[model samples]
Target: MPYEEENIQQFSATSSSTSHSFLRSRIGLVIEARETAAAITSIADAEAAGVEQIWMTQSPPTLDTLTLFAAAATRTTHIRMGTSIVPTYPRHPLILAQQALTVSDIAPGRLRLGVGPSHRPTIEGVYGLQHTAPLAHLSEYVAVLRAALWEGRVNYHGNYFNVHATLPRTSRVPILISALREGAFRLAGEISDGAISWLCPVPYLLDKALPALRAGAEASKRSAPPLVAHVLVALSEDENAAQDAARKRIQYYTALPFYARMFADAGLPVAPDGTGLDALARSLVVYGNEATVVQQLTELLAQGLDELLVLLVPVQDASRELAQLARLIGGMQ
Candidate 1:
């Protein structure tokens, strides 16, 4: 079966109305840990600029997410706030659920918690603790977290997770998983609220992740959830420069063993200067003029994405690039 035909068949199977913050101009901002004042300001600006959500992600899992989330929440009234990706290796789900609910209390049901089994470097190198069973760990963690937050009283025991606690269900925090491969995708759909994907293109999302999400939902006989999709974005007049910048970012991802394999699996060239960074350049990241960027991104909707969190790549002229993107995206909100 052809790829497009496969997508068509999938589309026909359920025909569920996918949730989108896109047509609603459901754009958001993603900032690094290095930016405190900048992140706060960016969130405020993005909200004022018509962006719908504000996401924060960084290392140390203790970059004062509470402070940053509180500040962002206090600063904006209408925009939703979320943790772009919080690693599960360092933080306990019950504790995180408590803190996330605290913030949601302040913001009143606007908290989105994105969890993941972080990479080996961040997991072992920095935390000095290694996770032997990432997928299993995540599955149990998300299950426990969801039960604690939404249902209550979860007594779970697995090689990676063992827990017995009476959790509070005072708040409903949306749990979004940072998923990529088949196992992670299954966990997200089977257990969590939604997914947050990075460096994955439309072809893969449409053909791969969405199907897994649907299958998970179908297997459980549960309703479908949101699918927040995002990637590094830049608007440059010179297409070559755009490609180069994208290449640099892609190199950062492909250099990592985990992401490199994901690239290779996605039909990208393996590195040795042959990494799937090449495919990432042409298909994944969108860089160029307004017309070109919009076209590339719109094409991504074919992947069944729900929201587009356009992460502006780091640059000295980030503000300029952001402004241009805002315009090209036809005014953020």
Candidate 2:
């Protein structure tokens, strides 16, 4: 079948709406730990600190996100759980739906499954799998996942996926897609419940991503979904320490081709040997004392962002930084 004809309905089958923050904007934290016990403790801590949501990142070496979420579901109540992104190439859509269903059953109306075709390096270099036609693969992957989780069945046959399966049960798990560029953002608007962006500067989101998302929604004849900005923030009284931490984390992405191009497009280009990291950090990271950081974050939320998925970069102490940041964010709410 043609791709257009095969374009399934947006993943919100039974949902009338799927906005991340319906009334007011919200803030969330990214909880990452090498140990499962530590990560679960972090989730409980975020909940106790009154953090609205907690997102987990999945990599080959990291703990499986769905399993972590299931554990968190049993431990914490009233805090939302989301996957920053679960790579699609590693798991088939049906299998992912099965795992997500368990998490959703444990914590109903609180699981947001964000998925994507991760970068070429991680997908190919780490997994030794051919990283080919990522957006095409991602489009079909969301369709299949939505069919299973929302409608309880899938009969999708695309270039990258051939799935005909019936799920044990349906769920209202809001499906979100990782979007770095305009194309992916548009795809998210058309097919998924929301778009989760990483390392995209605020201006780029306003100038490029939001326009593409609106265009996609206009074409699809549906309301545009929320754009959850993945912001790397550091809460520190010592400016130098915060900038140093931001540089270390921001430099890692400079080596990646996709992120490098995005940086250039966002008007903060780096040298071939990665020399413009300071400029990138200035444009990307929100750091300073409590008052200064809160002001910057407030301005960010004012820029029409539905939610800030804060990846806090610690300057000196991780736990202390998180607790202080959580208190500030709680005050914001």
Candidate 3:
């Protein structure tokens, strides 16, 4: 079957109103830790706080994402679990599909898989893998993954992947692509269930990400899927201290090539030595007292954000701050 026909058939079998409903209902939290126990604790805290979904990133030098989610699945029952992303360079589609399905078996109706071609520094410098034609690689990778996960079989032959296998028919796990730029946003809309964004300002999302995503969805003859923004939020009475901490977090991404370009495109300053980070920091990180923070987030949602995946920036009394945020979000409903 052709690609379009295959996609329609696959989605028809698995797509339901419930999948889209889940996206609209939740205020998600992204939790990261160097240790499995700490991560599971965060998951438990999030669950207890009435957080609807929890996301984990596959940041290198940290606990593996799947392991953390699997451990988290055993520890919590109701809250949903997801990967903000697992890079495609290091893991093949077949292996990723298998691992994701295993997690689905453990967690059942509560797994969302986010996958992407990560930036060059991690893929090339850290992993020592060639970062060539990433768009092509991701396109082919999604094809193979969808074939296996959605359709339960794959006889795919593409430039980057060649696989022939059949996997057990498991529950459909929504696949979201980590999209930053235009091409990536289109790719996510074209093939994947949703798009996961990081370190992008709200204006950029409205101007760039959303438009490209809509175009891709139109091309695919599918409704536009959920667009998840992984926003950095700091709740603090000490404005200066919160801005300082938020700037430090933004600085880390400025050093990265892909994010650096994104920052520049958004007209946020990037100093030679990565100083003068206030503009980007203020735009991306929501820092204020409880009321101010809630208002800022509300304004962002008004600007066409489908979901906000909150990443809490470290600050004084972080635990108390998280609890306060939980209460605020719980009241928002």
Task: Score every model by TM-score.
Answer: 0.86, 0.91, 0.90
What is candidate 2's lDDT per residue for 256-288, written digit by digit as tens?
A: 888888888898888878688888887788888
Stretches > 4 Å off in candidate 3: 1-24
- List clashing residue pairs in candidate 2: none
Output the lDDT of residue 78, model 1.
76
lDDT of 1 by residue, 1-333 (tens): 011233224323243343333343445566554667877776677667666666777577446665688778888897777776888888888777777767877888677788888789878988998866888788778877776676656687767768787755556677888887766676666777777788877677777777887778667666556566776777776666767777777676677777777666677745676545565787766776667766666655534566676787634487777756654554522
Candidate 3 to native Cα RMSD, angstroms: 4.5
In candidate 1 the C-alpha lDDT for residue 143 amounts to: 77
Per-residue CA lDDT of candidate 3, range 1-333, in tens?
123344333333123322323323445887867877888988888777677788888867877888778878898997888888899999999899998888888888788889988989898889999998988898898888888887899999878888999998854778888988888889877888878999988899889888898789889788777788878888877778888999877777888878888777777858877565887787888887878877777666656777788888879877677667766665554
Considering lDDT, which of the candidate structures 1 and 2 is the better prediction for this target? 2
Error of 2 at 81 (Å): 0.4
Best by lDDT: 2
Deviating ranges (above 4 Å) for candidate 1: 1-22, 152-154, 166-169, 274-276, 314-316, 326-333
